[model samples]
Target: MIQPSNKNRIVYLDVLRVLAMLMVIMVHVGDAYLFNAETMTFETEASLFAVLLRSSVPLFIIMSSILLLPIKKDNTSFFKRRFTRVVIPFLIWSIIYVFLPIPNEIAFGGPANTFTDSGLNVFLYNLMMVPFNFTGSNVHFWFLYIILGLYLFMPIISPWIKTASKRSLIFFLSMWGITLFFPYLRLYFPQIHGECDWNDFGMFYYFGGYLGYVILGYFLHHHNRLKAGQSMAIGAILFIVGVIVTYWGFIHDQNAFFKTLALSHVENWKLIEFNISFLSPNVVIMTAGVFMLFQNIKLSAFMKRVFTELSVFSYGIFLVHYIITLWITAWLHNSMMINPGLEQFLLTVLTFSISYGIVKPISFFPRSNYIIG
Candidate 1:
């Protein structure tokens, strides 16, 4: 069984949280290359690494569920605490990104200019639709919407999870496994369509989507009985399989696109939509495997301290990292002529370091935790 310390903190989870945040930076860094590829080629090692980084967001969701789903608090108290923690910081950062002077060429792929009157109005409109359509200001803000939706269901599911047996949890996971294939099923069979509509009551809806990862988090934390060796072995195998599937899937998609549309056009990048979804079965397995692998690690004192600090600032880092990424990547592109692969790697490091440097000091200010945590 999983156990927290007397203070109720799980150190391993802290490590996982830190790793997940770093992985998010990696994904954004990879985007600089993956999205801007000059040609339709998926055979590059950088592309494969980008595919591997797709697990980052799913891992974040899993970590959130593992920590939040076991709470015994009532819905009112839960919402009051959780919403305040996430939503306030979200709004603060959303507004910051909305007005930040970063040019669109760097921040996004538009012309090299700050917001125009029409752009500002559109940004404000999207902000006005908060908690529903958040992708307007920042694409990364989509995670907040998903988290908010999951939090809405947490109170209703918490009690059930507290009393749930292993078999029952397994059954739910199996149903979730089936739902993971829905994306691929739609790809091959476009006629099959429905939103978890089992009968009219949406009974299966409870067992679908990222909810499985949430429950998986709780289950793996509290109910896992696997030996350390066994867990690592299973995790390693799953991760390998996930990598193969993701790499091949994207390659196949890119080749098909190149063949269908002449390969001469850089604009005809078909591999853009071919990677495994975060909700794909491969990602689920990979995330579970990685989570389990980390669960069995014994961190050294120095490493533990580093992870603890990173975890504390992780939410803040997530909020601010994108701007740092855009600025740093733009500067690097303008000032230096380097390999795209090297640039991506350097951008990831610099973005994470600068973002952390900014957040670490802000974390000490009065009422800063509400903004950063």
Candidate 2:
């Protein structure tokens, strides 16, 4: 067990972290065979799976807020922690991902590869870009920028959040409404972007989810506010229903634009295409279900203990898992032939199990311990 600290000990938060990590893995695995340009074999493959996977990233952002918001640290200290713990690992893993295919593909008489081939130039270029802007498969590293941004501004924001007054909640809800609604509002107003908007700031979703979950976490932590049983029951019901609706939307809709208007609640649909990235009712509902389940569920003691061990590696896993998943997908696609649907399902499982198995064990390497934990 983690020792007592100035921070509150919600054993559940660790469980949440582990769940978020698993969600991320599931999202990527589903993405690889279902929607990835290289692996997608059939037109009908990218169905409800993409929508449901959409919950992963937002849930991760919310989980970050919950975990970090309670900590008492200055901005400088926070940066130092992240720079060492997050930024450094991100850079190292990004470089590794950049170079991974050379050895594997070279032996098969495939094309040669390098950092530029893998888009590392774009990744490195973003180090100099303005905040909230990115240019490459910085892949999963974008969250670090959001986390750092929030950490810097937390001292200013936490005061209002802590008050827990109706006014504060209203202010936050208003911000959320404007940010979440701003882009779609553009479809009607066209000039809405000219108005003062938090979405214009680009950090809005990250800020909104961060602030929302953190403030919510603080209240829950302080008051012991959640009842796991009731919350889980409600969340599971909504999650399943959301999945069904999201599936129906994808099957019937062809235009990416109409689909966004159709299914908004599923989680990983952003990977489907750029136009579908905007807020839709389905997207919001499904993501809410993900957050609810994350916050409310209880885990077995054995599972919780396993999560405690693995959650330390969560950051590293996120950073490296994409490349690992991609490689596995490519290998399976090339080496063995399977039916499209089974291939998709097996690819998902193979990618998840292999990536986690490899990374989780490597995460225990003594030299890597400082980087992962």
lDDT, candidate 1, at 128: 59
lDDT of 1 by residue, 1-373 (tens): 1122233567788888888888888777665566434654553756777777777888888888888876767789889887678888988888777677663433433212234454666566546556555543576777788888899988888888889999999898999998787666656764443433444324355557777888888888888789989988988888888888887887777667756674433344434554566777878888887888888888766666677777877899999998777667666752557766666777788889899889878877998967886
Tell me how many residue pairs clash in candidate 2.
8
With a 3 Å backbone cut-off (N, CA, C), the pairs that clash in candidate 2 are 53-268, 54-267, 54-268, 55-267, 264-282, 264-283, 265-282, 265-283
What lDDT does the true structure give each of the candidates? 0.74, 0.55
**What is the Å distance of residue 69 in model 2 from its true position?**
1.4
RMSD of each: 5.0, 6.9
- List where candidate 2 sits over 4 angstroms from the true fold: 1-9, 35-45, 102-137, 193-226, 240-253, 256-281, 334-345, 360-370
For candidate 1, give the lDDT. Answer: 0.74
Candidate 2 C-alpha lDDT tens digits along 16-94: 6666666666655554445334542324554555666766665656566666764467767866876777666666665
RMSD in Å for model 2: 6.9
TM-score result, candidate 2:
0.71
201 Cα displacement, candidate 2 (Å): 6.8
Residue 110 of model 2, lDDT score: 12
Which regions of candidate 1 deviate over 4 angstroms?
Answer: 1-7, 37-43, 106-120, 193-206, 257-271, 334-342
